[model samples]
Target: MSKQKTQPSMIGRMLRHLAGTHAVARRAFPSATLKAIQAGIGEGEKQHRAQVRMIVETSLSLGAVWRGESSRQRAHELFSRYRIWDTEENCGVLVYVNLADHKVEIVADRGVSRVVTRQQWQDVCRAMTAGYAHGAYHESTLQALEQLHVLLAGAMPRDSGDTAGANELSDKPLIL
Candidate 1:
């Protein structure tokens, strides 16, 4: 009898989610890395008025996986839940990393979407994912942040003496 390779079953996805615990997330993003990411976000914000938030999730909930929630969908949910879209210029960006699904999603607010093309955002995600595939998590994140900063600076440069456009979102990177 010949054995055929098939797509991963729902049970298999659930098992993958169960294996991707908080411990795995912690291992991937330790305290020092998180601090660096936070600092990177702050530095990036200084170059532009846009708010950048990074979220690294080890896995989706069993229910989420069962419902076939995509990484992009989860990223949009987080973007909303965390109020990334509430920035002054409406140029907030969310970088979501799902380890279990091996996916990277970049969700940009409408203001940014107007200036930055989807292909540009996808390129950023692909670069980050490439670094992640090689276990260069910290380096990859910082590089992606730099790329985002450039994009935001081009799209919405911080105006001189515009104090009202101050930091509107948390600088801390969320690990879930």
Candidate 2:
């Protein structure tokens, strides 16, 4: 028989969330790195019709944690809150990193999701997770952006007159 893994205890999860503060996120992604990520997003958008947004959060609130909010749920919330779904082509992608949970989530809008399978999105998340595990925050983020650029370019190439669509969303990386 196959065995299933158990989740961490509630107390353990709470402790981890408490320990992961804004300082922890700042340490992982300094100001320079954040700027680099923003630049990457801008450059990547030039190659595709999709909009990409990244959010790196230190941890969820105690209330959220107590409510058993998973990283994917938090990512979806951020996606809606940030209006990533309001892109012109409806091809916005959100990359969410929850440090305390050690989880990476990719939430793509319907237009992109129709072309990119869930497994493909998970693959991107896995690659980023591997790099994060090794403490390569900047490198991992840029790499994931490159991967998304490739996917978006293939799925929805930017037309010659689509320059206006480039800045549909902000390229800034939100650090929460």
Candidate 3:
């Protein structure tokens, strides 16, 4: 057998791997969807003293891909980069989505993690992934936000007479 070049296949794979860029993320989560999610987060925080941020990235960086950095690793990096783990209450949670890999991860701070197990967060991510796979992008994300609200609300109830806690973090959805 003779060796053959497979540049086309390699290129195709690379292109697909970089499919989810900021533009793609915006399409998957338009302004309307982002607002809905943000509203949900704002409301969700009212019942609890936890901070939550949702970051959706279209694809992994070329460097990260070259290094075979899994979506989980990227998620953790984003979680820290956004300062989700630096909340005063230590109840920060990050719901990250990587469109290219169809990977979803929920990184919760110690305050929340103390009550919510790793499996619980994984389950939520799985549900979101399933939703994305089904092409129910907006619906799935909103639904996930609702579920997270319930969990956070129960685990970290707000202080007495506190209608809403400080907006420790922006209620905006991040796209990268």
Error of 2 at 28 (Å): 0.5
In TM-score terms, candidate 2 sits at 0.92
TM-score of each: 0.91, 0.92, 0.89
Instruction: State the RMSD for candidate 3.
Output: 3.5
Q: What residue runs in model 3 are displaced by over 4 Å at the alpha carbon?
A: 1-13
**RMSDs, each prediction?**
2.6, 2.7, 3.5
- lDDT to native, each model: 0.88, 0.90, 0.82
Question: Model 1, stretches more than 4 Å misplaced?
Answer: 1-9, 163-165
Q: How many times do residue backbones clash in model 2?
A: 0
What order do you get sorting by TM-score, best first?
2, 1, 3
Q: Write the per-residue lDDT of candidate 2 for residues 1-176, one digit (tens) a residue.
A: 12222345777888999999889999999999999999999998998888899999999999999999999999999999999999878888999999999999999999998899888888889989999999999899889889988988898888988675658788999989
Candidate No. with top lDDT? 2
Cα-based lDDT at residue 145, candidate 2: 83
Q: Model 3, range 4-83, lDDT digits (tens) per residue? A: 44555445546767665677777788889889998988888888888999888888767777676778899899888988
Task: Evaluate candidate 1 by giving its C-alpha RMSD to the native, one decimal.
Answer: 2.6
What tens-digit string does per-residue lDDT give for candidate 1 at 49-132? Answer: 788888899999988998889899999999999999998778889989999988999998998899889998888898888999
Rate residue 172 of model 2 by lDDT. Answer: 93
